[model samples]
Target: MGASGYILRRLGYGVILLLGVVVLNFLLIHAAPGDPAEVIAGEMGGATQEMMDKIRADYGLDKPLIVQLGLYLGGVVTGDLGESYFFNQPVIELIGARIVPTILLVVAAQMIAITLGVGMGVLAARRPQGAWSAFVSVFSTIGYAAPVFWTGLMLIILFASMLPLFPVEGMESARFSGGPILYALDVLHHLFLPALTLGIIFLAQYARLSRASMIDVLGADYVRTARAKGLSERKVTFKHALRNAVLPIMTVAGIQFGNLISGALLVETVFNWPGMGRLAFDSVLRRDYPTLLGVLFFAALMVVVANLLTDLGYRLADPRIRTGGSRK
Candidate 1:
C-alpha cells in the first residue's frame, strides 16, 4: 500500500483497538473491589443509608453493570468522561491540567535515553574490547538493575539533600516569578532528576540493544564494501550501518512507550510531580472511577498512537517497508 493508504489502514485499526480498550478498562476497573460511594461518603465523615444511596444514584453507580457501561460509552462518545468523584471536576479538565507535565516528562526522558544510549552504544561497538565498552557494559548492568523509585530517592538524597544542586520535588519553584526563559529553566531544573530516573533503565536497554545491533550491522557486506572503498571509519559506521541499526531501536522504543507511562506512576509518586501519574495514584486511592477510566483511556490511546508512529518511522527509515515489504 501507498503511504497514505498505509496510514489510513493503521488508523482504522487503531480506532477499533481503542474501543476494545475502553470496554476492557471499564470492566476491569469496575470489577476491582471498591465502592465509589462509600469512599466518597467516608471522606465526608460518613453518611446515612439514604445519603449513600443518593450518592450512588448521582454517580450512576446504582445502575446495573450493563446500563452503567452503556451510559459511560455514550458519554465517552460525546467527549465527556464524566466528573471526578473525588476532585469534583470534569475528568477531561482534570486530565488537561495534568497531561502536559506527563508529556514533558516522558518526552524528556525518551530524548535523554535515546541520545546517550545510542552514543554510548556506538562508541562501544567501535572498540568492542576497549575501556569505553567496559564502561558501557557496567553502566548498563547497574542502570537496568536499579529500581526506578530507588534511583529517584538516591538522586534526591545526593543532589537535593546532600549537595543541594537541584530542587527536591516539584515541577517548578513556587516562589520564583520570572520571564519565560527563566521559567523554562526552572522547570528543566526540576525535570532533570525525574526524567533521569525514568530514562535510566530504558537507557541501559537501548545501549545494550544498539550495541549488539551496531556490531551486527558493522559485520554486514555493505559495511565491508564501504570500508574497501576507503571511506573513513566514521563514515562507514555512521553513514551506513547506524541508519539500519536504528530500526530495531525504534521498534523497541515505540513498544516500550506504554511501559514508560506506567512507570511514571512510581516516578511521579516518589518525586511528587503534578502529572497524570500523581492524578491516577490519587484516583486509585479514592476509587474515583471516572477519573481512573479517563486516565486509562488516554494512556491506551497514547500507546496506540505510538505504535502507529513507530510503523511510519519504520517505513521512513527503511525504504523496503515503504516500497511494499510488509506494509501491512
Candidate 2:
C-alpha cells in the first residue's frame, strides 16, 4: 500500500509535468513564424490565399493565439489532437500506428543496456583488481563515451559494408508481408544496428554507474558484517551487496530509459527506422505540425510513464524505500 501510494503520487506529478511539456510543444510550434495555414496547406498542394484562409478558419488558426492554445489544450484533455493535413487522418491514429515499432526499439535497447551494464558492473565489482574488471571497464567506457551516430556509422561500415553481415538500414525488408515470424526475423535483422547504437550509449552509463555503486556497496558496514559472518564470497556479493548497490543504478537507469525514447533521434535518422524519433525528424522537415506535435506528445507521455514504472520498480527492489513510509 505504501508503494502504491508512492506510485500514485509520482503519476500525479508526471501528469502535471506532461501538461507543461504539451503546452510548451503547442507554443513552440505555433510561435515558429510561418503561418500554420501556409505550412499545412503548402504541404498539401500549392495552397492559394483563399484556401489558406479557409483552412485557418477550419483549424481555429485565426483565433487569438491564446484562444487557439486554450482550445488545443482543452481538446487534448478531451482526447482529440486534431487531424493531420498531410495524412488526411486523425493525428492520434497516425501516431498510434507508428508508436509500436518505436516502443519495441526502446525496449530492446533498454534490455541490452541493463543486461550488459549490470553484468559488467557486477563482474568488475567482484574482482576489483583483476584483468576481467579492467577489460569490462574499458569496454563500458567505450560504449558510454562514444558518440551514438559515430558508433552507428562504424557498426554499419563494419558489418554491413565490409563484412556484409547485416542490412544497411530500415526496420524490415519490403519483400515480406511483415508476418508474425518471418517479419520478426527481418525486423530483428534491420533493428540490430540501431539497437546496438542506442545500447552502446546506455551500456556505457550503466557499466560505469553499476561498477561504482557496487564498489561503494562492497565497502559498506553491512557488507563487511556479511563477510565477517563467514558467508560464502558468492553469497556476500550476490545475495547481500548486489541488492543495495543496485538501487542507485536502478534509479539512474530508469531516467536513462526516458532518454532512449527521445535520445535516438540521430540513430533513427541514420538507420531509417520508422520510430517516433525519425517521424518527428521528418515532420519537422515538412513542417507537418500535427504529426510533429503528436509524436512529441507521445514521447513526453512515454517519459512520464517510464519514470513512474521506475519508481514502482524501486519499491519492489529495495524494501527500505517502502518501509520508511513518507509517501503520499
Candidate 3:
C-alpha cells in the first residue's frame, strides 16, 4: 500500500474503534448507579413525581435505553454531544472551554518528561555502574512506583508550602492583570508544580526505557563496527546507537501522551486546575451524564489518534518498515 492507503486504513480502523468506545461508554455510563434526573432534582430543592417525570422527559431519560442510544448516536453524527443538566450549557461548549488547560498541562508534562528522561537515560547508559546511573535507577524506580496524587501532595508541601516559590492551586493568579508576556509568565509560574507532578512518573518510565534501549543498541554489531572504524565516541553513541534506540522511546512517548491525559484527572483534582480532568471529576460527582459522556468520547478519540501517530512514527523512524508492509 501507498502512504495514502496506509493512512486511510488506519483512519478506518480508528473510526471503528471509536464507535466501539461510544457504545461501551454509553452502556457503562447508563449502567452506573445514579439517576442524573434525581441529582438535578436534589439541586432544585426536592422534586415531586410530576417534576421528576418532566425532568426525565426534558433530557430524554424516559426513553428506552436502545432508543436513547440511537438518538445519541444520531446527534453525534451531526456533531452534537447533548446538553449538560448541571451546567445548563451544551456539552461541547463546556468541553471546548476547558480542553485548552488540559492540553497545556499534558504537553508541558510530556516535554519535561522526554527531555530529562532521554538525557538521563543517555548519561546512565554511558556509565552504567557510575553514581549517576545508580541515582537514575533508584529515582526512576521510586518515581514509577509513587502514586500521582501523592506526588502532587509532596510537591505542594515542598514547593508551595515550604519554599513558597510556586502557587499551590490554579493555572494562573486571579489578581494578576498585566501584558500578554507577563501573563504567560504567571501562567507558567502556576503551571510548574502541577506539570512537574504529572511529568515525574512518566519521566521515570522514559528514562528506564531509554536507558535499556540505548544499552542494547550499544551492544549491537552495527555500533561495534562504527566504533571499530575509528569513529569518535560521540558519533558512535549518538549517530549510530541513539538514532536506532529512539524508535522505542518515540512509541512509548506517543502512547504515554494518552495515559498522561487520563492521569491528569487526579493531578487536576489535587491542584484544583480547571481542566477537562477536573470537569470529568465534577461530572462524575454530580452525575452529569452529558458532560461525562462527552469527556469519555473525547478521551477515546485522543487515544486512537495517538496510537495512529505512533504507527506513523514507526515508519518514519525506520525506513525498512514500509507502508505496504505495515498494513493490518
Candidate 4:
C-alpha cells in the first residue's frame, strides 16, 4: 500500500490491539489473588465484612465479572477509565500528572542507547579484531546480563554515594529555585542514572546488532564496488554501509520499545523517580485498579504509536520499502 493507506491500515490495527489489551489487562488484574475492596478496607482499618461490602458496592466491584468488564469497556469508549479506589482521583488525571516524567525518562534513555550503541558498533565493525571491538563485546555481554535495578544501584553507589556526582533518589533539587534553564539542568542531572540504567541493556543489544549488520553490509557488493572506485574507507563505511546497517537497528528499536518501558518500571523504582513507573508501583500496592489500568493502556498506546512511526521511518530510510519492493 501507499504511505497514507499504510498508515491508515496500521492505525486500524492499533485500535483493535488496544481494545484487546484493555480487556486482557482488566481480566488479568481481576484474576490476580487480591480484592481491591479488602485492600482499601484494610487501609481504612481492620477490614470488616460490612466495610468491604460497602467498598465493593461503592466502586462497582460488587458487580458480576462480565458486567464489570462491559462497564469498563463502555467507559473506555467514552474516554473514562473509572475512579482510582486508592487515590480518590480520576484515573486520567493521575496518569496525566505522571506521564511527562516517564516520557522524558524513556526518550532520554532511547536517545542515549541508540547514539552510544550505534557509535560503538560502528567503531567495532571497522576493526573486528581490535581492542575496541573486544571492549564493546565485553560491555555488551555484561550490560545485557545485568538486571536494571542492579545497574541503578551500582550507579547510585558509585556516583551518588562514593563520588557524589549526582543525586541518588529524586527528579530535582528541592531547595533550589532558579530559572527554566537551571531547573532543566537540575532535572537532567537526576535523570542520568535512571536513564542509563534503563538504557544499558538496549544499548548492548543495539551495539551487537549494529556491529553485525555493519560487518555484513561492509562485505556487500555495493560496498566493494564503492571501495574499488577509490572512495575513502570512511566514505565506504559511513556513507555506503552504515546507512544500510541502521535499518535493522531501527526495526529492533521499535520492537523493543515495549520492553524498554517495562525496564523503566524497575529503573524508576530503584531511582525513586516520580514517573508513571513509580505511580504504577504504588498502584499495585494500593490495589488501585483504575490507575493501574490507565497506565497500562497508555503504555500500550505508546508502543503502538512507536511501531507505526518505525514503519514510517523504514519507508524513509529504504526506497524499496517506500515502493513496496524487495528488488531495487
The lDDT for every candidate, in the order shown, is 0.92, 0.83, 0.91, 0.92
TM-score-sorted candidate list, best first? 1, 4, 3, 2
Q: Write the per-residue lDDT of candidate 1 for residues 1-328, one digit (tens) a residue.
A: 7788888999999999988999999999888998899999999999999999999999999999999999999999899999999889999999999998998998889889998999899989998999999999999999999999998899989997689988879999989999999999999999999999999989999999999999999999989999999999999999989998898999999988999999888998999989999989889889998999999999998889889988998888999877766632
Question: Least lDDT summed over 10 consecutive residues: which range in candidate 1?
Answer: 319-328
Candidate 1 runs further than 4 Å off:
326-328
Window of ten residues with lowest summed lDDT in model 4: 319-328
Q: Tell me the deviation in Å of residue 26 in model 1.
A: 0.8
- Per-prediction TM-score: 0.96, 0.91, 0.95, 0.96
**Positional deviation of 184 in candidate 3, in angstroms?**
2.4
What is the Cα-based lDDT of residue 205 in candidate 4? 95
144-216 per-residue lDDT for model 3 (tens digits): 9999999999999998768999998999898999999999999999889999999999999999999999989
Clashing pairs in 4: none
Off by over 4 Å in 4: none
Candidate 3 global Cα RMSD: 2.1
Task: Count clashing pairs, candidate 4.
Answer: 0
Ten-residue region with minimum lDDT total, candidate 2:
319-328
- Number of clashing pairs per prediction, in order: 0, 0, 0, 0
lDDT over C-alpha atoms for residue 36 of model 1? 90
Between prediction 2 and prediction 4, which has the larger TM-score?
4
